[model samples]
Target: MITLLSVYVDLALGVVLAFLLLSLLVSGVNEAFVRLLAIRSKFLWAFLRDTLDGSDAQGRSWLPAGVRDVFAALPFARDPRPPHSDQPAPAEAATVPAQETKAQDAVTNLLYQRVREIDHPTRGRTSIANLPPGRFAGAVLEMAAAEEGGVDGLLAKLKSMGSPLHGHLKGVWESAQRDLDRFRQGVESWFDGEMHRLSMLYKRYVKWVLAALGLVVTLLFTMDGLEYGKTLLRDNAFRASVTAVTEAGPDAYDELRARCERSDPVPCITETLSQPALVKVFDHAIVSVSVPAEGDPAVHWNGAAWWDRLTTPSHWPGYLLTYVALMFGAPFWWDVLRRITGIRSRHHG
Candidate 1:
């Protein structure tokens, strides 16, 4: 019974640790993808365009539209309009030209400025990354209140602006009916709900992208789920080492990565991973490994044969199984590993 329990504990620890590491690898690749493509900025821009321009919120992103023309003016978000549409124009319509007097509209200009900085490099810019509901609501209230009639002026402006915001404000205006505070509260709630939905949509997008990246990486590593599990279970020394590392907490990774980075003298892929130092100097890497004519079974994807990599039948099951494990994500595995380790500690203590 004691031996059985110990084996089970080791197995759980090994399995969870493997999954967590794999998930982290996928996330690392995804982070690279995001930076390379500017995915976060694109998503943030999409959300702002939905809110300000009143575009199809779900279909286009979390954003809006005449107000629709705002996306065109944004440097990062290029709406399918004329070249002149890239200039600041009145949010009232999509066709407003650069020469239009509506360019002087204070509210429209402010909103445009704010939306452009939705995700920015500089400070003092309106960042949607961690924008709170109160902040957005307050900005809206401030913009409206700054106008000639205060909130009433803002309401009139939104109504004249003629976008989905007009209807949204109208609903709040009636709902609040008499109290200004209620109107403010209603706007905050509305902003909160929209942000929540935006977050969900972004997560959905991230999930799909991560899965694609994870699959590619799994094949590259030849990470067979069944094979990995069997080896981990059978090798007591490997299991013990993994379990020890798992209990040591998040710092283990930082330490391991740091050590790997420093100790790695060779800038070779077939030699080292987490190649922080090499990537800094070189644009890319080219690592070669020995393989026979029949192809080395040990080598991942069999010596860079794209055709074999894509069409290999035996590799498919391993790739699928491991990829499925990775999709659960690092956070899930981290928590599981932590909890299981805690139980073991308590039992042993």
Candidate 2:
């Protein structure tokens, strides 16, 4: 029988290994396909345009003709169109007035800077999600005030569009003329209050994206949580070997996180007996859990149909459990690993 401490240690180690595998898988997918998909980036661009761009006489966006082009010019900008579409060129679609070029440049730059600042408050040094609500609101207001006509310029730009909120905004702008700080504070308060909705929207989109990626990753790696757990519980020698490999380094988790942040996969894989070592444990753990290699049993070619391998009554549940665990991300599992390891050390000492 397995000792209680052994169960905790095994479970914790399994979580750690799962996290590393999922982390690598997420990074790999992002590197390979995020630019190609551009789902989030396109959504971000459209959301910014709709939120910030003013409407013209024809009820179309008046926020300069080359605004999209300008955005496309930025680093990491994603064009929503296919690489070789038969559609009309952007220049053929929208024409800008010569006089409006300067204004367009100003507005585009302001919007770009503001959105970038609000979305990535650490000046692109950190994850966009790390930007707090206060900093995000402050960045938006600061950028608005920094525009051509200052706060009034921003209010005028928004008012020019004649949005439904124009009347209320006009009153706010009028009051802001008298007390800008108070206006900013009120706007910040409102923005903060609505941030939960924004966060939920972001999470909803990202959750689906990650779920799709997680499914691909789970199948690609053949991760089987139930089988892996069973293997660890039954194999003392394998468990001790992997645990010794992982626990060799004191700063292993921190180092792994730092490297992951930098996207330095080389150091993560080969440098330590941590990331790759953890992955090896996972591989060995699931070795006995087999999936279909070839084809339909109906055709007499195989052990099981591919669909049966994926969705049969006995198989998919474990794979799905593995994918859900991957969705928890590395940091969460890393913390669990630390806590369980600490507990073991205390108990043994």
Candidate 3:
């Protein structure tokens, strides 16, 4: 019974541990994917810039001389930018004349002016204003140079091309960043909530698992007691005693009947023997017959009947101790093992 209980409890504990581990792994994976999604665009931009040697437009272009060609040639390069919808029409740009570039710049300027007219106050505020003038101007010149001209000529021409469209682009970028921050904050809060819920569920599951294990142990202990009782009753001495009594039953009854009929002969023998007080006398008689000659007086009595002899106080302590040990010992050992192995305690309440 003890072995069965231990095996059952161990199996239950293993199941609970497996469940907790699986939950933790799933939670970890979910968190990782959420975090990855949160910064996917930013990381993508950085990767494209580092590997493709191109600006956003160039990186997204689908033309022969675009980032695709550069990335294809540089085997080490990896493009990570999110796919864009309005990449430059590099095929059209390649066909334009040198003189037409100035006209295209003028048209671009006109478009920006129209956009400013439409947006009014929200137009000019840009991240560029937060940058050093030298760096900001250099960035504008580099963008223009990537179009067609050499760096020096691009810088000279940009002075006459009105302010660049960086201000509008910066505004959009900042707005996107703000939205991303809000999204990340929400994701973090959700993760925290999920973690808390998982913790509570884990605790609940552990409690139920432990409770089941305890029940199993209790059942095993009860079974052990029953087995012990069976063994005791099956012992050679006990079986022999029962057999002898059964075989001598008729003679014993006749003897008892004759004794009951005697007068003065055991004064009111039938009445006295039939009374409850006679039980102790019978118990004494049985005890005297059962024990060894040199045995302790406490080991047996001299006047007990079968029932009284079995219920003697002298033998009761051992039975009580065995019963108590069977009922409580397995759980005690299980608890000790759990503690030694650093297993968490289950909370019932």
> Per-prediction count of colliding residue pairs?
12, 0, 12
What TM-score would you give candidate 3 relative to the actual structure? Answer: 0.17
All-Cα superposition RMSD per candidate: 12.2, 14.8, 28.3
Whole-model Cα lDDT per candidate? 0.56, 0.49, 0.35
- What lDDT does model 2 reach? 0.49
Q: Sort by TM-score, best first: what order?
A: 1, 2, 3
TM-score for each of the candidates: 0.61, 0.50, 0.17
Q: Write the per-residue lDDT of candidate 1 for residues 1-349, one digit (tens) a residue.
A: 9877887787778777767877898898878765654455545545654444444423443333223232233334543211112233234322222232221333333554433333344223332345578767766765665567666666666556544566777788789984779988998999899878867766776677687778776765666666556655545543344355579765445534443455642332224233222121111112224333365633232345544544668767866887898989998888899899774434653
Q: Using lDDT as the measure, name the better of candidate 1 and candidate 3.
A: 1
Assess the local accuracy of residue 267 in candidate 3 as a C-alpha lDDT between 0 and 100: 44
Global local distance difference test of model 1: 0.56
List where candidate 3 sits over 4 angstroms from the true fold: 1-178, 221-349
Over 4 Å off, model 1: 35-38, 55-108, 112-128, 237-312, 343-349
As for TM-score, the candidate ahead, 1 or 3, is: 1
Candidates 1 and 2: which is better by TM-score? 1
lDDT string, candidate 2, 1-349, tens digits: 5567767676668656666657666756754654544434444433333344433234544222342332343224433211222222222112111133222333333434433423422222212323344654555566555557666665565455433333544565576664767766666665565455545665565556576787777775556677666655545444444454488754445544543456674454443433233344333321223223355322223234333455556656778788878888755665677776674334653
Q: Which candidate has the highest lDDT of all?
A: 1
